[model samples]
Target: MARQRFGLEGPSHTGHDVGHWDGLKAGELRIQRCGACAEWIWVAQPLCPSCHAFDPGWEAVEPDGVVYAWTRTWRAFHPSAEVPYTTVLVELPQAGNKRVLGLYTGADDPVIGSRVRGEFESAPDENSWPLIRWSAV
Candidate 1:
């Protein structure tokens, strides 16, 4: 069972929490990277799709990026998800134009290619996990 130690209870590994805190703790926007081909890949992969290399690793990345794509969800995808949240696809120029998907805060509509920075929001008082919110920079 997931512990409620943090007010915002989240998955530790199976879902969203996969590499979540591990990334934050390292001060990195840790996305799956292919060591052999040196390509940043998303949606989680054990192998590199480009070079077919099994030598995958996590690397630190800058929080800065441009909005490659985005959407405003009026309906809740998760019960814990706050409605009217803006989800963004951030294009990391430093990482081969690979996009990092995250929730955008402080706005309803976000433009494609808009500058944005990652914000690590505290995961409520009792929660020990690292939660992040993004916004226009």
Candidate 2:
């Protein structure tokens, strides 16, 4: 099936999390890592949760993971979003078991521990933000 574009808005792409959107535009999955403790921080924080270090740097990680958990939503939260969409929490082993949330685009039901890969979709318009979609591997 073709890649689906979910009409959900993301967090502000400013400050610490700018690299994440930039990475998606460049076809990479960039995440922050604490320079001191090397701990992966998701949702992009200014300080490392583990070591509390300032100015954590960003690194490109492989967009491959397993479905740690998931849920199917029947409600359309946004105008661009459709009913019966699935969101999956993917566990990235390459990034120290850090889980990244993304939209699931597959026909079968979401099964826990299923291998999935990331697919970055550019925004339909300049005003909208890009997103990562996951597919079963």
Candidate 3:
């Protein structure tokens, strides 16, 4: 499942999250880092809440990670998503241990601390956008 599965359509890529979407389009995982304190910032922010640095820089990080947490959705959180899809919060070791959420795809359910890797999946429909999905390694 992609972000569009929830009708999120990902980001507009015109504002704070531009670097993130651009990186995704380029098949890279880029996270914002504080220029001053080197704090990793996910969900994009204009300034570092940790050090109050203005405008963080985008840096590519390894897509390899591990499942920090996971849940199998049995409820229809959104109409576009089929029931019983797995969603996971993956912690990137190369990215200051920042955890990011994504749809999980694999032969088996994800377990906590399971090794995983992220990959970009092309949009399935006009309303969707390319998004990263995680799979067990």
lDDT of each: 0.69, 0.83, 0.83
Model 2 Cα lDDT, one tens digit per residue, 1-137: 43546545655656778877778877788888888999989879989988889989888998999999999887867776667788899999998888988998976788998899987777889766778889898
Return the TM-score for each candidate structure.
Answer: 0.74, 0.86, 0.85
The weakest ten consecutive residues by lDDT in model 1 span: 1-10
Per residue, candidate 3 scores C-alpha lDDT tens digits across 1-137 of 43436658567554888888778778888899988899999878989989998889999997899999998888886767777788899998888899888888864779998799888887678666678888988
Clashing pairs in 2: none
Ten-residue stretch with the least lDDT total in model 3: 1-10
Q: Between prediction 1 and prediction 3, which has the larger TM-score? A: 3
Model 1 TM-score, all chains together: 0.74
lDDT of 1: 0.69
Per-candidate total of colliding backbone pairs: 2, 0, 0
Q: In candidate 3, which residue pairs clash?
A: none
lDDT of 1 by residue, 46-107 (tens): 57888988747777777889988988777756665556666788998887787777777765
The full ranking of all candidates by TM-score, starting with the best, is 2, 3, 1
Candidate 3: C-alpha lDDT: 0.83
Cα deviation at 70, candidate 3, in Å, is 0.5
